[model samples]
Target: MACLVRSLCDSQPVARFQRRCGLFPAGGAAGEQYVVKNYFYYYLFTISAAMGQEVFYITFLPFTYWNINPYVARRLIIMWSIVMYIGQVSKDLLKWPRPCSPPVVKLEKRTTAEYGMPSTHAMAATAISFTFVAVTVNQYKYPLELGLMGAFLFSTLVGLSRIYTGMHTLLDVIVGSLISALLTALVYPTWDLIDHLMLNSPLCPAFCIVVPLLLCYNYPKLNHYSPTRADTTTILGAGAGATIGFWINNRYISDALAEAATHHVLSVSGEMLLTMLAKFLVGIGVLVITRQIIKNLALKSLCSWYKVSINDHKALQQFRIEVPYKFITYSSIGLNSTVLVPLLHKLLGLN
Candidate 1:
């Protein structure tokens, strides 16, 4: 208990440096000096963190599952993958220490061990919020004010939450937000072009899957203290899976849906709502099962082939074992999202 208190209360080197540089107030316990000590701020930031989590984003999966808009679904998948890839690559390359580390701000979440120059949370929030606004307002003809205001408020709160939690500095938040904005602007315009080039071509899906895998395989090595490779692998795998799934859907499922439009799966609003709920439940269940099975199989096969015990952490550290496992698992998820779920809905006469 004493040690835990010391860890929480002691001034980190980064905090001290920030104090010297006038970024923070000098001369008190880290918590005492920071505005985050207030209960309101703490709770607010905590909620913001939760909002930026991957699981929170999964709520948007129903949009795709219900076939609300295929274009929107595709954009969501691609945007998520791109933001994660860029944010993680930047984190690894910059190798900046998190404010929570010793000689930085007091650690809020001890399990957080990654570098934190530009916070991925901030970047993701910005990317998702911005993309949502752009899609809804410009493409879907939603009210610009409503879309912009909501996205701006959400993204701003998420960015501020990072600072309040001592997870990122002001500069980190700014950079993260800017990176998202820039990427969204560039990528949004190119979506139509990419669809034109890749959607109809037989060879394009193969290229998409191979290229991302190759990139992950040859990803740059970290020069400083290394974080787990699991995050990167997951992103790559999901991207690959989405790529393949998009192709399959574009070629097969989409055409079938168009032709089946006259079939009239649901005749009333209540039935449509019920069908959407059922699809969400069933689709998510399949996705979870697929992810777990692939992860276990990959781990077991790799362990056996490499002559290493599954429990041997030190031995596993020497191998880039997570790459294949994450790729397969997330790809299964992506493929399931775009192809399997839709097919099931059709076969069940729900859509």
Candidate 2:
């Protein structure tokens, strides 16, 4: 087990695996002194990275399913998508290089090929932990002191991990944490107002869809290379999906599910557990299939319409075809998670 952990912690093996997963650049400059060779730091940063992963957040969905109140789930999904979009945009606009091997420490799992300013990992950790604690304290009447303590500890570890691994400068982590805190403070109070407007306004869908696309279109031009196009498309697609799904849920699903829950007696723990398991299985399957189909179709259609060959990597990147493709795919995922998945639950008599 120790050997396996060491092997997995090795930079070359982990980096190669990440590259094959299409999550990192194929090659990057390497250096000896700057690399985090200490096994202890390697494991720590690896765990830290996993904590900040999108998949970890997705696990909260099942809890929402069990509770029958998706308020927290929806908020988390929307907040994460927006935060990532903002972080990626800022990184691209700044176009700052990450801590390279010669001058600074380089860590393993350096998958993202984007600029390093205001570390997204730090931002995401702070945003998620802070938002979760805030919601729990405000809505659920949980103890504020305990929530704040836990959140502070988690966010601190995540921020420290970035610096320890040499993935970001101290300033980057500080800025990232501050940005997340500021955004949370501003958005939390206004979310209800925004949610009302989005649900009621006819222009909600159009606004949500168009605004993100416009943001992508107007992204700052940078001479140096960055994953600007890919990152923009990912968030835009997710934002669009979440927007459409939220609208659909407000129109069709939320009230019905609430009514059904009130009408029916709560199930026993065993039954509830089984239902949750089934819901997760079904929901994940549908989401995976929907994402794959939409991504393929969107890419093919966009390539043909732009009169660019799919194989022309340079043209695709230059024209930002990834924007539309990711938009369609993530939108489907968002829609599936909110609208279709609940409807399926109802059909299956799980809710």
Candidate 3:
């Protein structure tokens, strides 16, 4: 893949086109443009991740590259279930032939004991490509034409690599790419709604930084998961409840107490510190009660209405830092929330 792309970057025709377009100004330096371009496409991961963890793809080119967010792994997991698992099961049921064998190549042992029908890596890469599309097209001003061309070409190459590695057939890779693209189309609408809605508020930090993170860290599904619409709603509710409780406690409750203490319309004592304590407790009580009701409703919505799986204790579990750095890796697993969380934070100001 790198070879073809790198070769494309070095092509004389492409160089001529760039020169004609004035995109490769002589002042920009020669010879290194293609190398830099290839670096951006194939090796931009050097500093993207947190400190301490790095990796490199030893392709025809053999240098370490930084790891993409762990959440990409999560996204692949979900994508695989949709594309690989379901597709593989369908083939088993229908008895599809293997490409390597007259029937199929001998199935390889997977680390997690999962079967392959469609290609997981292919689906995941395709999903990431779609998300990059949503980010450039829907979230940012990056040109859609270039973004899509890159995404499609990149996804295709990644898919093909799986076939060359004997992990999947060409048919499996194609189906996986289709599955990812389809899932991206299905989810991004709801995903975009969350992104464009709450980015600028004081709670933007909570939605973007806190919620997606907290959800992903909580893991049994919640851990390492990014914030969802349900999480955003709860954050909004909690923020509102906190704001209101603060106003009521500070303005009314405090004044009311001062009046009782001094028998005046309003009075604040120097020594009545316990009263402030009481007010603070009341505010916390309001927050807790409201949060509980919201959590219950969220659980009910998933369990009763949507029939989605619910990890009831997800919110309370401790995040594992096992292989400690893998935590960052795991968080990048699911692009559903990944694509939504940032755009939600950028476009909406719920705080």
lDDT (0-100) at residue 22 of candidate 1?
Answer: 35
Candidate 1 has an lDDT of 0.67
Q: For residue 112, what is the lDDT in candidate 2?
A: 42
CA lDDT of each candidate? 0.67, 0.67, 0.36
Q: Which digits, one per residue and each the tens of the lDDT, describe model 1 over residues 1-351?
A: 987534433336336434443343334654434433345555766788777765665556435535465565566667777887888888877876666533354425532567776777888888878776665454454578988889889989888766655677666777888898888888988977775555577886778678777877776676533443567667667767766776777777667542222121324587778888888887778777887888789888888988889888665544367677667778788777777877888888877
Poorest 10 consecutive residues by lDDT, candidate 1: 257-266
Report the candidate with higher TM-score, 1 versus 3.
Answer: 1
Instruction: Quote model 2's TM-score.
Output: 0.79
Q: List the residue pairs that clash in candidate 2.
A: 237-327, 241-331
Q: CA lDDT of 64 in candidate 3? A: 7
Q: Write the per-residue lDDT of candidate 3 for residues 1-351, one digit (tens) a residue.
A: 976533332334333433332333223222222222333422222222111111111110000001122212222222322333334334334333333221112212221122234654666567755564554353334577888898787777666444432345555567767877887777655542432333224453344445434533442332133222222223222232222222233344433211112111224465434544443333334334533554555444544543444564453222232111122222222111223222232343211
Task: Mark the regions of model 3 whose C-alpha exceeds 4 Å error after superposition.
Answer: 1-114, 193-351
How much does each candidate deviate from the true structure in C-alpha RMSD? 7.3, 8.1, 19.8
Model 2 lDDT tens row, 113-166? 667777788888888787777655655544789999998988888877766555
Error of 2 at 341 (Å): 1.1
Q: What is the lDDT of residue 15 in candidate 2?
A: 39
